[model samples]
Target: MTETMDRNFIWDFIEDDLANNPGMKVHTRFPPEPNGYLHIGHCKALCVDFGTARKFGGVCNLRMDDTNPAKEDTEYVDAIMEDIHWLGFNWDDRFFYGSDYFEKDYELAVGLIKKGLAYVCELSAEQFRDPQYCGDLTHPAVSPWRDRPIAESLDLFERMKNGEFPEGKYTLRAKIDLASGNFCMRDPVIYRIKYVEHHRQGTKWCIFPMYDFAHPIQDALENITHSLCSLEYEIHRPLYNWVRDNVDLPGNPVGFPRQIEFARLNITYTVLSKRFLRGLVEGGVVDGWDDPRMPTLCGLRRRGYTASSILDFIGRTGVAKSDSLVDIRQLEACLRDELNATAPRRIAVQKPIKVIVDNYPADKTEYFEVSNNPQDSEAGTRKVAFTRELWIDEDDFAEVPPPKFFRMKPEGEVRLMGAYIVKCNEVIKNTDGSVKEIHCTADLETGNGMPADGRKIKGTIHWLSAAHCEDVTLHLYNNLTTLENPSAKPDDKDYTDFINPESKIVVEHAKVEPPLKDAKVGEQFQFVRTGYFCKDTKYPNTFNRIVTLKDSFK
Candidate 1:
């Protein structure tokens, strides 16, 4: 039975249903409004919707809930599809749009009116919200038009659809309750006059159904077994059922689609609200929706986050009824765990300090063997050039050493990783009072073999040979906002006010091994002790730091 598969309440309910009915496959749908780019928040819903069906050998429909056409666009529709596909879910041929069922939705509305369950009201938008007429549905003032003849409502509704009346002239509302405590049941507006063209159905109709009205009908028409949605829509469930039970919908998940709710995903230092994300893009606080620093899925992808890593992150954040904020490190940790095993190893020095092996032959350059990935021996090995002149990180050397600073200093010994151990003998200073270069001599006996005394080196640092190094740009990123919950800040303060000023920093003078110069876009590599990096999508010879070596995300 499906109940034995998982302990989540949603699957439990489905299991019980399948057990009693026998031979009914679970069906689900992910209905997204095509208004803006999808952010990480949507990933949670996608997992539930598609994953549940996949678990039961069932099907999930990808529906565009594009009823409100005023802000919808084809660009957003395309992006949504691209992001979902990138997330490793395929809806196949079971795709739909709410506008595709608009005519059927209208017919259902007319059926409700003819049955005296709905009516057209002349009250302005503000009047519906008045204390006397709304809210206290237990003792509410009924609209004057509520008691009008059904014929009058049907006529007005037909006219509304025909554009005979101007926008805001009237609205068709459900005559559900005048005394119900739930506000959603208190004669909610079903359809409103909108004199705008829809992205898919242009100028074909003047009135459009509100989201509350269209959503359930769309689900019913598609015969979704479980109408899964975020917890924010829990209160809207009653209305979801009202439309399901009131209007006749074909097929069965034992009567009508059961609306199930789960918590949405929220991460610290990231805002997932499309409206707020749009502000960041429009205000230029970030580049665009796909900016590597943004939290949008495209942005994460652009930052080299893998679909498998995202799925693993979501798995770590199991499904629950109550909402909670996850630390961003959990996501980064998943990437680290993955890249640590799969990424090829390479040597890169971002802040280079020149080092001359004074005792070694000046024109000498030899190839030293290095493992591509120590975690996976099948990854093979690559050769790195060992030379008399090399580039090591500027921070690796200190003119005046601190306690236990074992990397490099005057007369300090450190192993140049994959090559010979070297001792810094002299420090050359520039006229500006800065260390210009460090002169070192290689221990001839330590080259590619053990010393006779078997002495151990305490510190090993990566180095790039000057003759074989390629200059590459590195893009490092930080949290976009200073506050963990920027969206929850005081009403008077804009989210942009919390934007981290140093969100993205570029190191244009970084040096890596020559082989890295031919790294194709989207290829990932581990820069020895530095961090995991991926070739940038838009920049040649540039890499985006995916995640640092250490996990500091608390």
Candidate 2:
């Protein structure tokens, strides 16, 4: 069982329900539409759904809400399952598809017609939205076919199911109050005629049931005790109850499920809309849905985010009734905190510049032992080669000393990490006036120790033996958009306009210690002062910088 100290208003309600109704099983379901890949925004709901069930020692079913097949695909179904499993949750044998209840949805619609609770409306979708038919707050909506006889409505609905009418020619609307204060209660269309073939059901269904009509029925049939969903569906709760009150469902031991809504996750500088993400994939703006820069779960996984770190983040965020924009840095902090202690240390020189230990014996090589993870005592140590020729990051040296520069400089002393105190005595320049190499004399007596003269070395820089290192490609990722809230951009500007141009920077031929040569795909490492990196899952000899060491979130 998963242990959590986190508590929210939802838990209070569930506790009350359990108390009032003894022997109540806290069964829940996570029903995702198979239209697009899951994103970080969905992680919140996933945790609440599966986490709540686990907390109560109950079961959670995984259902694909494939009611709308226009944009749905089997690919999304497989991806959804994979993502859920990767997040360390499972539904076991209780997997289902919304289309599995299509025939039952049709039967329920016919029953609603016979009970004078629904009717076959002739108004086109566009015409129904016209002010004359969709009344304002002061006026009630008008429908010419609201009074159509049940016999004729049933025949038309049946024919509509059999493809007798063209798309949008007929619709099955719940016969709710047209004058209700809530707009959703005003004769909402529960079923619409669509000629598109379903991904799972194929051509067997042409007239499809709307989400509001199909969802509650599926919950009741599955005996779901609580239908936890996002706050956007709060207004639709009345309609959800209306269906359960009217439909004479089969033997459901749990009666009807209660629908609960909570705030959805919104992160600054990120867009969670699948429609927008799909546009980016189709327009070639990103490599694909799993691009490291995208916010999709698969993208984050490929970029080196761990499931435990993500879950810890969700737990800290807590559940709220009102929506709020979370700083993306908080998410980064969680990853950084976990990786700092768990990831083994490795040396990687980005934008390398050669360094020669002029005083060291050129024919000899020594091994220096360095802690794999300073934060983890049991992680132990690994030996790194120390040779006469070394590679260090170009930034570690400055040709002209800046104010209070502490790293490598002409005639300045610095510590080569895990090795020795070295003093730069001369700089070798290329024809272009760039520093081609730095020549330093190592105080061999101070190997990983202070100098004998008690001189302070203010800077320590990581380096790899030039002859013992391997070249690798590095991918550094930043925020996808420059704007803090791309969804709130000005009316005239598209969200895509704010896409950060430098979101991903690729560095080719970066040098790493030989130990990394055998690093397997998806292995994470702390690149000693560079950042945390993970071996690329898609490309060979490539590592993606997961996040820098700095913590910006307060």
Q: Indicate which candidate wins on lDDT.
A: 2
Whole-model lDDT for model 1 versus the true structure?
A: 0.87
Q: After superposition, how far is residue 108 of candidate 2 from its true place, in Å?
A: 0.4
The 10-residue segment with the lowest total lDDT in model 2: 1-10
As a whole number from 0 to 100, the lDDT of residue 55 in candidate 1 is 82
Model 1 segments beyond 4 Å from truth?
A: 1-6, 136-142, 449-455, 552-554
Write candidate 2's Cα lDDT for 354-435 as tens digits: 9999999999899999999999999999999999999999999998879989999999999999889999999999999998
Instruction: State the TM-score for model 1.
Output: 0.95
Query: Candidate 2 regions off by >4 Å?
Result: 1-5, 250-255
Error of 1 at 95 (Å): 1.0
Per-prediction TM-score to the true structure, in the order listed: 0.95, 0.97
